[model samples]
Target: MKTPPPSELVAEWPLPPLASLGSTVRAIGIQRELRRHLPWKMRGFLRVDGNQAVLHLPIEEKEAFSAASAKIATAIEEISAYPVLPSEVEDILGISSRERHKWMKQSRLKSAGTRTVKMRGRAKAVTFHVFDAQHIEDILDRDLPTIWRQEDAAMSAENRKRAAAKRRQTRTQARSQSGCAGSADDASGSKLEGWDVFAAEGLLRAPRK
Candidate 1:
């Protein structure tokens, strides 16, 4: 016997501009949030399509799909409140990992909070900072990363110059001290040689001379 085709239910939610900040990572994050409203088995049925979250389910489960879709719709309305992940920020801002770490350390990249996720197969978990979506969007619109990169470069150059000057000053001081010590040693040796010569010439007293 041949199997019959099952009817399917389809729905899609257009993601807001802030939902992803134009970053694919951000879009996927929103997609995952929508999936959370569905059963674990049905979660995989929801996926990100460009700037939208699309859901596909068999018509036989229309009730479950409708309930889940309502929750997901509500979630979409509040998607702007979602915290932007570290990777999403990197993508949205077009920054490298080093730049992200440096800026974050200096408080240039403000963190919303920290997130901890367990590895798929490892026993240990990884923790990282997450950023506010609005904050990130503001930064992107202002092209702040370019400005930040310039500032960081300038600061690094200044630090290098200061370090070099300090090293030079230390070397100069070392040389000055070494020269003084050598002069003192030379003076002491001269006195000892004179005494030895005088004693050899007259074991008694050369004080009269």
Candidate 2:
């Protein structure tokens, strides 16, 4: 039996009207603020510039987007349909290269592949990775800074504990060696002791002549 091919979605472009684009941009902003509790189809989502927003919509819906509500749907449709790029993710996340690399190493952000581009005057090309928008969005929703800070605090505490333990061990060794000395004059007498014993763990204070 010949298996049929999967059907493609054939919806026409829904270019939103000037007013609708504004609504849609506003809607996207609102949903982001409200943590997406409200549906994106609510009113006034687009930015103040309807011209740019309108371009995001299908050609058909451009004229009919009069009511604020209708435009909200168009805006939602645009975001759902648009191909988000890596640059867009960087802008939306407000992260620098160091932070981005940190996330990539930690597995918070995933890349499709490594990209290489040559500069006009460069001897060699530069290679970099591209990330998916959905993965970036997941980071935003999870509030990565919160997790990063918590992990840092825990690590700092552990380091401090280890440092204190090392200090205590050094102090104990010094006290044991000093109590074993029969006299302060023994410092000059122990020719063999100088060859053994741990390296001075702390600074040695000399006597004033």
Candidate 3:
């Protein structure tokens, strides 16, 4: 059998604004997405430039490489325009799930829609809210997450203050009621003592004092 020349092929695509979106975490996510479409052995060999994902393979495997390249292109297009998933939103915004839920419910983070996807090995499908990419970008540019967190902390402090004030007022009212009851009991006892004294002095007809 004749030996064939060792042939290699390479392809790359820029990640554009995505590269600037979520920092290192986002890049790792993009790399994972790319690797998901590749073979396990090929996954570990994948390379990512600053904002570009590159794939290298043997020319003999051109067909597979082409297919993977096409998928990558499609992924890039979709990621560029697609609404942000909840996880992606958290990464890009640097917010926690609790904070995301709070902001979403408060209308601080608007929802573009919902996404339903079945687990790879499960029959059940999960649905979650998706956010507008542009809107998220705007929030990021404005550093809104930090602002919101600060606002939340301030509000929490205010709530604690109000709760403490309410408890103090309740205690004060309880003490006032207790004092009034004590005074009433003292008055009643004094009246009884006075009556006893009068009866003893008059009714008993005291002899020589």
Candidate 4:
């Protein structure tokens, strides 16, 4: 029924600059990745401090901390290997959800691959596109998202213009067809007008038997 002792073992690792890309969420992702490499029970002991993750454990848990520290160091070394997540892509690229979706769909923002992870409170796992760190960096460096957005806007505008032209052409054709039909009907009516005269002349009547 006593409080646990203070943590005496400590270690820290700076987050990878490319992985974090000055995004807090991205940094948190790196921290989460570090935690994943450690034992589940000890995961909470690791936390983000400024731009790095620090691990703290009690003196009695020194051996466990040592092992966790090694894992964290290894994980940090390979932090760039972690896939750039969808949210991270948005933040790092300063793009909207729609932009991200559009570019990804068009392969402008090419996905290195996909990653599946279970949501914290959900029974189902969600799968999404992940980008390579270098790929993201390249896109950011070239400001490709802005270019993609401009291209998308132009495409949408062109599509709308084409659609409008198609609609106009369809209407014109419909009107032309209607005019022809009306002319035909008028001509037929005019021809029928002679039928009365022919009937009066008995031409349209059967010969008297």
Q: Report the candidate with higher TM-score, 2 versus 3.
A: 3
lDDT of 1 by residue, 1-209 (tens): 98887689998989887888888888877888878877899999899888888888888988988987898888889988889888888999999999999889889899999989898988999998988888998899999999998988899899999999999999999999999999999998778647878787886665774
lDDT of 2 by residue, 1-209 (tens): 99875342112234333212233433344344322322355322333233333213233443433343354444555454333334545555665667667767877667767668798999999887865445555666687756875896898899999999999999999998887775665766866555443346423446556
Q: Could you arrange the candidates by lDDT from highest to lowest?
A: 1, 4, 3, 2
TM accuracy, model 1:
0.79
Across 53-113, the per-residue lDDT of candidate 3 in tens digits comes to: 8888888888887887787777776656656777888888888999999999999999998
Could you tell me which 10 consecutive residues in candidate 3 have the lowest summed lDDT?
Answer: 18-27
* Higher-ranked by TM-score: 3 or 4: 4
> Tens digit of lDDT per residue, candidate 4, span 136-199?
9998899887787788789999999999999999999999999999999999877865676888
Clashing pairs in 4: none
Pick out the ten consecutive residues of candidate 1 with the lowest summed lDDT.
200-209
Candidate with top TM-score is 1
Please report, as a residue range, the 10-residue window in candidate 4 with the lowest summed lDDT: 189-198
- In model 4, the number of clashes is 0
